[model samples]
Target: MTVSMTTRASLLTSLRMMVLLAALLGLLYPFVVTSLSEVVFPSQSRGSLVYDENGTIVGSALVGQPFVGAEYFHGRPSAANYAPDQVSGSNLSPGNATLRERALQEARAIEERDGVTIGEIPVDLLAASGSGIDPHISPQAALIQVPRVSRERNMPITEVKNAISSATENGGIVGQPAVNVLKLNLALDEQARGMP
Candidate 1:
């Protein structure tokens, strides 16, 4: 009788411990972490979404996306087709013939489209970054595209130049102040609205 009672008590104690651990580790822990993250890092917890002038969700500053039209400043070329879920790069060697040819083709197209005779095309504009989802382009890349956008949008070059400057991040601080292409394009839209 004593042995059976001890066995039953041990089993019940183990069962209670399992239930308590499940409740604490599984339920309580996740809830607390999630709740705290929502309060502390709300925008990041919600995908870092950026809004348009009209308060509509445009895209996330965290992820790189493509501009649909040519009138806008273009971001780095992507290897993953700019799919939000498929962030990646071409991952080709520097000497890869296919990569070289692709870069050449991109440079040719950009030159023709922008009506510029480039002695050397910007590497950022030609090469895909490690993530290939780089929202920012080098300031030089942005500047090269300026003439085309200004001509297409019929906005003054100065306004477009200022927009690019405004969109650049950490100029000479952390790294070369790269311009976020989407942000510059948005600024251009806002600036153009104020034009005659």
Candidate 2:
């Protein structure tokens, strides 16, 4: 049986429709989604980065890293060792002896530096966060290290506490207060350097 011109034209039309649909769904859909995300959530689309007063990008507000010196407020322990690409948590269980040993050493070091009892160490201060990218710390975590930071910087504890308070996030309806480590650390650097 020979196909008519009309039947061939109909098959060609169906093929064109399939190609158009594939282009729209596969290419245009992703482009639209990306454009919308950039428009609606720009900071997040850009990695929620924090910038210093010099307009230099310092780091993301979502991920945490270390501040080794006594003058800076330390962030939570990271299993990735502060590498963004290597984000991960230490998988040691609570009952793991190595985990306990590491936690105890960390707690002891914090206590000695802060002049606080070992019991006062915040759990977050000793444990690596899941994903190892928590940029915020509990207010309690910030406070426990305040004395040490203040003493090292030669600033009053009250001033340091005030800074922490200013850095704190509202309870979000009876939620506990929290501090963004990046912002807080930036503010401390500014204050210490007397930058406006």
* lDDT top scorer: 2
C-alpha lDDT of candidate 2 relative to the true structure: 0.85
For model 1, residues 4-41, the per-residue Cα lDDT tens digits are: 54455577889999999999999999999999999999
Report clashes for each candidate as comma-separated counts. Answer: 0, 0
TM-score of each: 0.80, 0.82
**How close to the true structure is residue 183 of candidate 1, measured as C-alpha lDDT?**
77
Report how far residue 165 has shifted in candidate 1, in Å: 1.2
Backbone clashes, candidate 1: 0
Q: Estimate candidate 2's RMSD in Å.
A: 5.3
* Residue range 116-176, candidate 2, lDDT tens digits: 6888777888998888877878888888788788888898999899889888877688776
